[model samples]
Target: MTKKHYPLFLLMMLIFGMMQVKAQTSLNDIKAILQSPYFEKLYSNTYYSLLDRMRKDGFLPESLTGAYEGMYCRTTGAMVSLLIETSRLKEAELNIKCVLDATTQNDMERIPHVIGIKDNKYTIISDEHQIDGQAHVLLAWARLALKRGHTNFEDKTWPLVSAIMKRTCDRTFFQHGWWSVEPGLVRNISFEHSREGRRWDVWDLLTQSFVGAALNDMATVAERRSETKLAADWRKKMEILQQGIRKNLTTVRNSDTTYLEMRLPDSNGGTPYLGMGWVTLSPVAAQWEGLNHQVMRNTVKAMQQGMLKKTNGLAWMPTDSYPDGTVSNEIIGKGQAWEMEFARTEKDYNRIKAILDLIKIVNAPKPVYMEGGWLDGNGHKQSEKISDTDLAAMNNAVWKTKDAGNGEQCAWWCWAMARLRVAAGLPAEPARVK
Candidate 1:
């Protein structure tokens, strides 16, 4: 070969070798982050705290540090997801049973948002039925049952599962191919919009996406049990829901790119919401099956372009503001964790590393890992403390937001780290405690 061509060939080989090295380095970097002392301490502390809060009836408080006294079904479902991801199947099942027990206490077939304990008796705290909360709990149960791989597990849970499906599929809840937040229930419009003044009726993307996801998951379980007709029905419902989501809740921007709306206008005269926040990315973050891959990619791209910002030289996403000018933007820990999960799904190792670095930075100042709550854009914790009057006005029980670490935030961060390890070809286990 000529000397000139030989030099070019050698350069090409050098570039290829460097790429290989970078790939290997990326895997090692993820492993080091997972194995770091800070990660181990946070995971261990949070895991034990969750277990400690488990009652005889399997109730676990939403957060030990916050005014979170009752067992919030949505938060409990997320904890169950974390437990299942970390291979704690028995614990996950226990939590699912707790949710089922709470769900059946009413004749309306509606799952209460929060279940509290009074005088050693389980009591319904808030009857504000949330579609996504119900879906999350059901999905967690289905996932745990599937993971157990025992036919009897399915048989034991099928009755409760069927009841939930019956309620969730009821026309009052499932309207127009998408699940609607109950009318006049005064539910939070979205997780990010929880502080916004009361909304009696709303249709949120998180609810729609999660309901579709739950249906798909239940369909898988049904197919596993050879319930072909039921499985087909659920699948068909999911397909219709997906289509409705695309047709009604998506808007075309930049002439060709489609993005999902965070909330849709209700018959009660609510306006359509188009925002770049965590709620807007729920379809992808929830990993709903059969969604258009390009749509998810575009939605994430749009969100990053608009809502993604840096705090303390690390990346994070800010929650949206209320249209009525009640609550403004703030950095939320769980939202950032959700973004990290999406990054891990996309195999964006550099982005994952940046988020991990941010987590370390946020917790470095705290005595212990703090609950996933509000933070300023500058990375300082916001005062989550709620006054008694404010709690009463909101119709909530004592909700003293504590500065100390709690279970929900820890579970989210740990879940992300564990999933990242799995993405890097490691087992789905927490880091060894040092």
Candidate 2:
């Protein structure tokens, strides 16, 4: 921990100073954030929270006993990363195998979007298939399997991943592009944690980031297996994905800057919130790189102009921007946390410092109330109001923003475990970071 650490500083102290820290983060400073009181609390509390929920039946229910109780496919991979980073080898292997063992086959995809745990047995709970679920798992599997220098684990797991990630047996996507979820549609399709209606499918900055990371993971694993041809192919795909995103999905904001859109332009043409969000920041989780990633530097510049809010303490910027020309006010801690890691990836010390300040303000680990992020157009707090009311009974006066819809709790912020990994110099699992 840094000698400068204090457990009780007021959250507002750095509200102004954080912006001035444009300097790069030293490795020691990164270690300091990792060992800081906030990180320790975030790491241990969240890990235990998930550990307590790990059922002997080999499933980690979304909630111990609540309406939202079930398994989300994305959590497992991020959880596996947590265990691996912390040296919980057996436990990590158990979770990885648990998820693989329970994978149910669907014509649509092998990896189910949601699974329900009941009386020690888990079953598919939804028809939905999300690319993020498969991406997170593949990334985790690749990293852990590589660390052990063995292909047995991947050989065992590959059948399922291949099925889920497979675009065509002919491997047509190996050249052009790939989807995040399987039966991988290239048109409007429902995706993970999205309820605003089907957006463009096939690819998005959000899903492609993770999928590209997975491709790189597979590339590394293939290289390790001495499958040079396969590794080269995977590497090419990863590059294509990353470069494609850098090329097609960004807009020249002005002569001096450019920013990535939330997803490629949808026919719907909704929300200015599109360009500046987790959609841009979330890509920091991957090993994929471009000739230059100035897109993020510009993104941080654009976001700071408005997005990151200060109510209830300095919060990460809200999730979405609406068509009405207003950005969200409610803070989503998971998004904030992951964005902090994104800053860490870029060595943006000031952003990381601001986010750590927020964890202290909100008492993140203990109860994990993801501070509401939807803001009134006037910059007043509306996160709680918007979250409390989902689609059907929205408030006329309230800002329209949809949250993760866990009226109860989001499995004690299981995502925190992985964000901690990113803070510890491991890559973040984008989709699962939430």
Candidate 3:
């Protein structure tokens, strides 16, 4: 009741009110950036523009002006996810048909990593049968079916989905719950860090996480469709896979949990740690349910400490740990986008803003372009130039430094931005082409 006590009470109330205001301002600030004209234009240009380049058969090439040819299944699957999330149901359906059409015309039911057109027919370009690619496509199908409210497996995509599940379940190599990446397979080419001619026949965390997630998705679809036995089988496989990941692919030291990039097949093999890059981020990126929250936090902490870098004051995560034991300083566009999504999930507002700033800066000078441009470690663009008309016509998806865009990178970036918008409580749907 004293005047002195009243002053103290009033000051406390003032501090609490200021704290509430600061929290609201933080969220509002994020929303403002996401809703800005610049951000909206970037999303529209990356998305609808890329869709404009899709082939009649639904084949979206890896790059527009770059040296890439054919359709990468994994990339196409990413595009499918983007389309479905944006409510482009018709486009998503056509893309799914493209994937089914590309499936090998054999009993193996194998889906090639790259399917190219030859004589108006789909030909296998790289037949590595990557587990993650398979997972991506299967997950895409499950998502599309679920989104369309198909609860009885009566959708046109059901037959293909069933065949893929059967093939996956029948693979002898996958009998152990988690499959290993075979040595000399072309799948290594898609992995940024493992592309340097490394001999690998080991269990990789990326593959495990993706496959596990896909299994979960498929199981949900099966459960909804009243496929009780199939759902139970898939749930069991997922549990085993999760156990395998935890028992073999994770390590702990000084109370800090670290997920290994790949576990050696044999006991005598060396340590599985690969210096923290995409592989380390995969578990969280896939949102694997088996992962402990503390483990995800530790993995993010490791990436921030080891892989985070800056160029011209813009933040990026450089590609790390080639097979030759050397690190790269190049900013793989897709990798940065993946990290951006992760940052948004973790609510690291500062990290998200830094990445957005980097993207805005790199893409600001949009007229000139190149195919497969070299973005060196120091965040410099090194590639020959093309005209603005060419870029507008092609509307490539991926932008690596100054190189002509690729579909995979563009899809990933757009997907990340879309997620950011949703997080900011803005519209999840991107602006349609005018």
Candidate 4:
């Protein structure tokens, strides 16, 4: 590779270094679970029932109010979105209220990344802030509003949105007219793949895309409420963000362009996302306004060839990796939300089906039910060993590790299935599946 072409080559090298998990699950042998009657009835029914009880009993964790220092809580945005999609409007609204009520002076600090679940009550389990988590919660609010035609709970919901954005006055909330790329983009500066508090200048693709989408959605709310100036400002800022993302995040591979992870101000290269579905979930993948089409397609190609699992082809992406095919993650079902969303957005039927085949409960040969998500393969290098399972046993070995698991109905697994239903022209509700 010559000097001019070495950057893309090196980017590909960084991707190829991701370890391909030896999935224990058989990709071809995935049962016709999506076509089954039990998908909406038996499996999901059982899972959601359990989740509701957990919420009532304080056994489950809420994403917004509960987060740990060393962990990533990705479920809130998706979780809230999933809740709204399932006709659980009241429940979804209650959860939204719990998050909104915390906009006070003392509560604003905890607002960005507070963690915990409300079990008939509210609480905080972790105080660590994750920009993506904040973006997700914001996105969730937007989605819920859109779904509700932007009404019904405006008394509380509107106040919350107004308050959060109003914090731009306070340095703690956002900057005044902080709409420019350099000074305006809210910098949550975080690390992907649980780098254990490693800080990179914010504006990473994952957070950028999510935050950008959220901003646009909020602009819609502003327009509806007749906040014309605010709406216009938001749109203009979103355009600038769009320009910023393209300028900072795009890279070339084999002359095919794609977006890179973090584009630090003085960085030589950008970070690649190996943690399952973050790439596909990028704003580009979401097909949000202002993304480069070639870049998006190239991104899908790069991930499928280099970042995704080569073993079963359906489990998950690597948690961490280098140029030597080393990896440290297993199958995470929720990550599939982006995978399925990307596939649907790209109109790739085959890719969409691959994701659905995994979520189809019956296709899961293992005895486990969906919780967070399940593995298609084992990551021996990625996780610890259990007493019953040998050093490399894959699925049931979860008692000894975190970061990988089954897809529970109330989590990303179920949410992904819902997206698939839309892609397949089926009812979004799994229960209505034929």
| Per-model lDDT | 0.63, 0.54, 0.64, 0.51
TM-score of each: 0.79, 0.70, 0.79, 0.69
TM-score of 2: 0.70
* Candidate 1's TM-score: 0.79
lDDT top scorer: 3
Flag regions of model 4 displaced more than 4 Å: 1-32, 37-51, 54-74, 102-106, 109-112, 116-121, 150-152, 166-185, 195-201, 265-277, 284-290, 312-316, 320-325, 356-379, 383-410, 432-434
RMSD of each candidate?
Answer: 7.6, 9.4, 7.8, 10.9
Backbone clashes in model 1, listed as residue pairs: 67-399, 67-400
lDDT of 1: 0.63
Candidate number that wins on TM-score, 1 or 2: 1
Error of 2 at 141 (Å): 1.2
Per-residue CA lDDT of candidate 3, range 1-434, in tens?
A: 89879999999999999988765435467778777777777777677756888877787877766667778888766787788767887777777677778784533475678888887877787877576777777877777777887633336656677767756654443445223432211122233233343445556777777677777888898888788898898888777776666766777644787776775555342246555566666765565645676777777777777556544455666555433333443455666677788878778777777767766666666532111222332222333222223223333223355444677778877777777888888776776634
Task: Name the TM-score of candidate 4.
Answer: 0.69
lDDT: the better of candidates 2 and 3: 3
User: Which candidate do you rate higher for lDDT, 1 or 3?
Assistant: 3
Residue 144 in model 4: lDDT: 76
- Candidate 4, 1-434: lDDT as tens digits: 69999999988877666433222223232234455554555445534542454343223343222222211234556556666656776666655555554334236633444434344333454555666666666666777787788576774567666555444223342222433335334455553443322465544666667767777887898888898998787777677667766665666766776776554443322344422235444563233634756667777687677655433334445433333444444344445556666666666656655555555532344222333332334444433211213323554333222322232224655565666565555655555212
| Alpha-carbon shift of residue 360 in model 2 (angstroms) | 2.9
Residue pairs clashing in model 3 are 329-377, 370-404, 397-410, 398-406
